[model samples]
Target chain A: MSSVSFKDFRTSAARAIADVRLQSAIDGATLTFRTGRVKALADLPDVDGLRDQLKAIRSATLARLADHLEMFEQQARAAGSHVYWARDAAEANRFVLDIAQQHGAKLAVKSKSMATEEIHLNAELQNAGITPVETDLGEWIIQLAGEPPSHIIGPALHKTREQVAELFSREVGRTLPPDDIPMLTAEARRLLREQFLAADIGISGANIGVAETGSVVLVTNEGNGRLVTSAPPVHIAIMGIEKIAPTWDDAAVWLALLARSSTGQPMSCYTTAITGPARDGDPDGPREVYIVLLDNGRADLVGSDYDEILQCIRCGACLNACPVYQEVGGHSYGVPYSGPVGAVLMPLLYGLAENEALPHASSLCGACLDVCPARIDLPRLLLKLRAEEVREHMLTPQERLLENAVAFVLRHPRLYRALTGLGRIFQRPLARGGLLRLPRRLNPAGERQLPALAKRSFRSMWNEIKDGQL
Target chain B: MITARDDILKRSKQRARAAGDHPPAWRSRRQFDDLSRRFVDSLAAVHGEACVVPSLEAAFARLGDLLAEIGAGRVVVNDEPPFSGVDMAARWPDIEWHVAGRSAGDLRAFCAAADVGLSSADAALAETGTLVVTSGPGRSRLVTLLVSVHIALVPVSRLTADLFTWTAGRSTPPPAMITLISGPSKTADIEQVMAIGVHGPKRFIVILYGDED
Candidate 1:
């Protein structure tokens, strides 16, 4: 939404890495989520079995997503909800704007939704002269700070308590203590409650869309998800096309694993299933319900080599387990979805040209694959994206030439050995304590040093040993 | 537009893997011998309180004590079975009482302003200490959501083994809304520190009655 180029990643990541407070926040938050996920899964009985079952369901549903989408549209319409299809972000935002304008809506309350963020709905609404109030605590903080979410689940994990207190105090026009978290929470609750009561429309993101029941299930620990869906006269749920779970049984498996993977809870405090608007005899809930299905380049990936990326549930476990994410933090990704999932999906969804650097952000450590509840092979996807980038000539000219030279050397063993021997002889002056310290301008790795080539080539040593010569 | 829908479906049909048979059946097994005991212990683990009573009369007696202890001056109760027969207005004559679906005042506002909201749990899961309440004619969604403290009366017969079992036994068509509440509303958004009572009820108390004295 903010329009960032991958070329800026190095600068942005360096800035983020240099912030001590940010490093502390990132380290503390990710460690907590990682350890909590481990303990929560270990406490459950047959956690792996449930994950396997969920994966099977996800794969099966994706294979027949079109049929499931038809069923969902039919069932949702039968249950009195209007279903709309948006080919891209603009169409989706236009539908939401039309609904808000039709009702003369002035203020709209939003629950935390990565779909909404992905569509850049807030800026669109603001430009349209309608105020969109984010109700999630972390989201609200970042909204007030005029920044995008830094984490998929915790939108403001980048902000410290002192920073939050400062933000809240500015809003309340009074100084509040930084250490009093409960007081800050109460202040936020009191402030958002007014917006909830007076808003004309509510917008949310669906965690899962059930085709058989025509229900959209949302899971949240805070009650904002419920309030956003319940308090307003009209409610709109924007969901990715890949979020379909065809049956109630499939939904049960998702519910079982979603909270456990994301927040390490047996279940989030609330798991709400809304089939449609308030029924005939219901006293509360929105009168109008709409679900906007957003395609936005995902359909192209449906049958592509990376279709398994569709199985991702946005649990943020991969983010917590990612080494790159832990070091550079989420803001460096420049998208709402970050870490291993971002490295793969950002290029696939946005385009490889814009995010060519993202695929290289990982070390292919495979830690993300180990923690993913959906078991998405993020490392494999990253490698595939990198290969595509190279094949498409997306690399810089210098990089292309370097790659060509390396390939040429690798093909001819004699040239490689001769060059290495020459490099060992030529690098005596630049080699400092076995590390090649290149100037910042020439060094592609920036601050990091390269290990100097071995003084004696391995091939020569192997040959000498085979000949019984020391 | 229909064209967008058609295009998306076309791409999906062309690209998606062949659909497999319906997913393997839900196979979660409940380990606890006494589901009610397991439910109580599970509920306690999530900062919720649960008590077992012999009959509806005993539960009502305990309910009265809880109301007095909470100093509930204003209360909202759902007009569903069991709760509909409690005669809350007559029992607590002085409190501003509102019964959902049968009250004179605005039910949503009353639930929001009331100190305690009461409802009957249609069913519950013992494994996760979850209470499933569906929105229908008499059950208002806000009764348990908007109050400071929520008290639900559960019958032991309505307890299920877990979510898997609950879905396996679900026979009727799905309601307009089904809420599965496991604990009091909570958030860890601020520095990943757990905070309670962000928007929903702060205290969740369940009265599991009508079996095994």
Candidate 2:
């Protein structure tokens, strides 16, 4: 795995919240996705039942993942595809590099795949002197801007039209209008068409790998997935070990829910299934096909308490439905996978100590669970991580002391009352109207104002009312 | 040293739990009284054009009119059923037609510059207005993918209620490649603005013929 700098969530979230343009962009994109999901799910005849069916399929698949994988390997090999296993990112990258070297490939066109992003494959290819081109419009935009993807489905969601126009103008050596989205898209199509045709290898991430036929399925709205898999002579697909569908029946359920949850479309424009390399007498398609099953910390998660996290299909509904994610955006999570899924996943994939702030990023909102097609209890997992953090003593000394003091006071009502009395006296100077305006240096609430203490305690009021004193 | 495959498999097996019974196959309750109308409406909802014709001959006539309307100079087609025996070059002598796997002179080159790509769908879904195309001896994946305009002739008999119905009805293993095309290629990556034909066909047309040749 490529080492990403651990920018604490507080710092990045604060920075993101302050950017007005980014805030609106995040708000607009997430709302669109969230609303689309609601409407799309409503259109289904038995969405709840469908969700349950998908969940059961995922659980059953993960339960016997090793056996399914072996079966998949046999079937895929029988179908003339070479299957390789990578225990970690290093192994996966090495396998890809060897393939490129063996083929003497110079250019590789890629469709959007988060698994590749997780392993940072492009950088590895770049170091080995092979040019990697991102063919997805969002991914391509971010690639040109030299930035990490902020959204899983829409990698360039954080960028505005004006910013994209600037990037395209610089690339084409001409000033393009910022508001003309069609013209910008056309420019991208014209430029990327050349790369697609000239590329020697094509790399994609498998959305689902079917064990029945040893097929790798790719879902995309644009036809780039088809072109990438078809245009190149050598096609390589890298998938996480957990992304397996035992049969076509299971794959059907997955496909039915994936698009509806992610983009609110009944179905994406294209869902391509590649069984193996091109068949005999086939006029087009790659001659050689490779499916690299990547573990990269996934196998270790199989039977753990966090095993349910492995059931994630990467639909990204949790991100759109998350309150914290909507406000701060994906970059605030400080990893490729962000939002509620990232909060629980990054800490487990990496060490909890290194990503200590992630588990605390959520407000324990269950919106993610409600919208999740797989119904992974993200908030529960987040709580579990928080408990683990406390158990491991990851909190700072001051925070520990504050927690201890608060616990002690809550245990004794008399002590709490006394402290409240003292606090009311001390807070008189800061109280303005109904809000408390603490000094800038002492305020921990940031932009939000604290509520002033009540003039009389609720206990006292209750006692007076009980005595019939109006 | 154990190979990466063996080591990973061991670790996974050690943690593997007992496999439970697989869930029963889900059947869609959505029944379309008229599959063709539903298919047309669903396809149109996603910016795709669709029409129902009484017979295959009428469908061919409609396709000819579409070709004439677009003023297509070059056309690439898949040599599958319904199109295999037809003499496209003789029927339309004014335009250049490249029949995949049959009369092919650089199919890829023709597809790249072709005005329209023509094929027949193996099956279609009424729920989402999707066409499922499979690649085989004569079917090229790019025929329906690479052109600016794509025209698919789907028989009403191949229409299923939805994806669930299609999956449950399948008796054979899938081909080398199977694609479900719902609409013209589109993107909302740029400021959430919808742009059509970023990489694939800008226009997708479906002609549903009722009668078999």
Candidate 3:
């Protein structure tokens, strides 16, 4: 993943906030998802109990993830699947490319897989002279526009109907109406169907890798996942080492909560579990199956402070519930994973120094925890990352100086009171209706005014009451 | 140089924490007074069609009616249990029948060009209105996936309370592939607007019938 600096986040977030079309699209999509999630969870008999059960399952699985992964590899090999372990993205991408090259594949169809996005596999495929077609409608839209996904579940939620129509019109070399969403969707289906049939290889990500049966579970509302895994002669699935379930029973619970939290569905339209390639008598299915287990810094996080992030099923419920994500949209995070999860995961995966701004992206609001099916304490993780940043001296010298000075004044109540009294007098010229209308050049809080100092201090009122001078 | 697998395993082991006790199995309290009614209502909520009939003969008649109602000329059927040994071509002589794995022509080609794909569910979940289908000797995965419309004949006896009940009761090894389909293929990808039949069946129909005594 390319490193997005703090400056980049500021620039892009400002641009996203100013884009009216993008703002409305994000708002409408997130609001609908939030409302749907509430209704769906309300229907559950014991949602809190289910969430606790899920958290236990995930934490326990992670506690001995290596054992489960080894068991999975053994079972998958028994089922005739070739399992390859990749230490990082380069190795994973190289393995996939080698498979494509060995098969002389020209076109590779892919389902929506964040693991692939994390490894930047499409560009590698393109560079190797193979065409990678994203089969998911949302992923395809972003792929066409040459942009990263703004949201995990709804990749094109930042786009309006008019923008999508424009992109589709360009692709087909014809004029298309923006309002006719069905026609647009039908056109995509007609076009992608050919790619599914003609593609020589298929690639996907596993939502859950069951250790007991050596199965890779894929949950999708569209049938692209089914086609991508079924049509091609060779299928490759890349997954993080942490996406493992110890048993079929455990996977069932994971599946029960995954769709409900992600899209408010009782179950996704298609939940296909591929154990291996087609059986002997099976007339049609993939001929070869390859499972690439990607470590990619995930193993190092096992016992770390951020290990709970590995429990994320990537349902993206936190993304829908985050206030910062709702305002700036997902592109500001500048990663495949976005929202609160991205804010914490990116910094940990990449480095604290590299993704400094992301840890501070949140207002520390605990909405993500409330909606998380796994009940990951995202706010606590963010705080930990921030503290790590401070401990490691990731902050700039100026920031460090400012923080120290503020700390000093806060420690000295007399100085703090004197400064506040002076601040009130100095703010008389700029103060207007409880806000300080500072000049644009002098204002650091752009587009928003800072709250003015109160007319009198609380200490002054306390002293007045104490002296019976109300 | 160490192998990626060996290195990853070493690192994971080095950082491994003590394994916590496994949580107890979750038993769902979701029970329906009428499984068939809940099945129909739940399926209908997701824009799927379901009807409970009296017997296998009625179910077959309903399937024929659906094929005729859609004016489907080409139909593909999976040669699985209950569907096997049933000569669909003779029963529906007007429709072009392609029995997967037993049919002479290419199954993929037949399904791709077919108007409706038909199969029998291995099991059904009433809570979510899901049909569980597995791929094996006579069952083809594409039979229910590639076509525009998919119709399944499910015995009411196969219906369970939900996924919890289904998984807990399984005694046999899973097949090469197992799919739990809850509704017709749909997407809300573009501008968050719902559109049906993106890559799979536009309409999913379930015919539930009483088990033969």
Candidate 4:
């Protein structure tokens, strides 16, 4: 899940922006998700009220998360599931690997799961000599291509049909046309079906865990979630500690909003709530079930200012609505969680010093807040992260000096005006056609033209107008 | 690991010291006068087929017609309350049959190779046209999944107003797996193009019968 450094955010974003295909894919997919979100929310009667209710549920649940977790563990264990608590990514991966080794699982089929991706479980499983086959078409495509998912819901959104065709053709040892989408889907189904049937263990991530019933809810449009859990002898579900609801009542509201918010559907085709392993007389399902409650840096954020970050349901709605995310795509964030959420989370979950630039990746447009089902205050958190960065003296020396100078100038009107005047005079050397064309080394914006400041200051213009010199 | 669990929970409790208690909100309910009609309409909207039959005989007829339409020769049926009295194998002797826990074969292999899976809904939601099927003593999850077509026999009496209504009134512990099948398996993952029947059933047909008591 680790990629290019967040300190190199500008370089990564610039590279993504320069790729026409990446831009087009991001534009097209984000637009679809954005419009779809609008329509889906509009169809509901009083969506704002629903969003508020969901927020309250999330807030109330998190306030007493330990209680809920304990309850879930008791109930899940009673229902024949082994619940493991992992302090961090390494522990979580180790538990999964142990399960795989215990079952002698040479092949493991996986459904689309961001939690698994966040921990880089596939790489660990591969190192342990288990072929972790991704069953979700988008995840499978990216897995085959040796690339990370560019979108949360639509993992292969960055890849074009022609590229997919090439990938499929290579797998099948034959040439295939790009335009035949159904055929491509058929090919995936045929290949993944075999993995599903033969795999000894299946791994998935929980969308939400219900404490009342000890059920882990998984929503999927494709049936891979079902196949994964049902086909294997052992099923392992990894869930972030935050993904919990106290009761079935809370799970209901989450299910109601999740599909609509993400994919514009009233509900996804399948919403399975698995309490434990298969029952005694049940025909098919995993014999052993394991629930790994992952608390990787989340336990510390329980009552922090950024605690609301845990409210995110991984809908990818915020990603679609973010202007910066739409421009540079998910990979630019350099984390499994991307977009506005990633900006705030990556810095907090990882160290702020290592990922200092992520919090500033946003334009603070608040489009994310508008469409967020949980109504998480993302922009406010981003601001808090930025303030923390400044407080910790994490910014570069040049950036700090520039910020201090600007702050000082803004404090005194005379100094601000004088500095502006001097800047307008000094900028002439690099100013051309009403834009600043600074040398490549000196230009911070890099490839983007900066509009030259007006010849007259707004304050001076206002003063002149007041003197009746119109 | 246990020590980690204790430490994590301990920190979480300390941090949550300032949080106030909030009682769970009672969700406002949605009402539908004709729930069965709404159920059918909702199911149709999501590419699922649903029909209201006047009697059990009519439901059986509809199921037979659906099977014939899908050209399903080998069917796996769940042995539950709704399917108990019906000797499906005796009625359709020509078609191969495998009943959960009753059939003499490997249930997984039978389901994976079967053309149709038959089960009965424990409950359903009118608002979303979702059939709630649970795995228990006589029921098999694979009887609904791992087939080309899935036929669910849902009685009208089992219909609830919506998801909230059903969840709010829950009295017993959940089964091993409670599946809410809204429609046939689908995916728009590939360039946002909708493709049906990815891994589960391609066709989901609901036979709604047995009027409310």
Model 3 TM: 0.98
Model 1, runs deviating above 4 Å: A1-6, A425-438, A442-470
What residue pairs are clashing in model 4? Answer: none
Best by TM-score: 3
**Model 3 residue B80 lDDT score:** 83
Could you give the candidate ranking by lDDT, starting with the highest?
A: 3, 2, 1, 4
DockQ of 4: 0.71
TM-score-superior candidate, 1 or 2: 2
Question: Candidate 3 on A1-470: residue-level lDDT in tens?
Answer: 65667787877777777888888898899998888888878877888988898999999998898889999999898888999999999999999999999999999999999999999999999999999999999999999999999998999898888989999999889999999999999999988999999999999999999998889999999999899889999999998999999988899889988988988888999999998899999878999999999999999999888899999999999999999998789988877878999998888777778888998889898999999999999999999999998999989999999999999999999999999999999999999899989786543326657889999998999999999999
Residue B115's lDDT in candidate 4 = 96
lDDT of each: 0.88, 0.91, 0.91, 0.87
Pitting candidate 2 against candidate 4, the one with the higher DockQ is: 2
Q: Is candidate 1 or 3 superior in lDDT?
A: 3
- What TM-score does structure 2 among the candidates reach? 0.98
Q: What is the DockQ of candidate 3?
A: 0.85
Ranking by DockQ: 3, 2, 1, 4
State every prediction's TM-score relative to the real structure.
0.96, 0.98, 0.98, 0.96
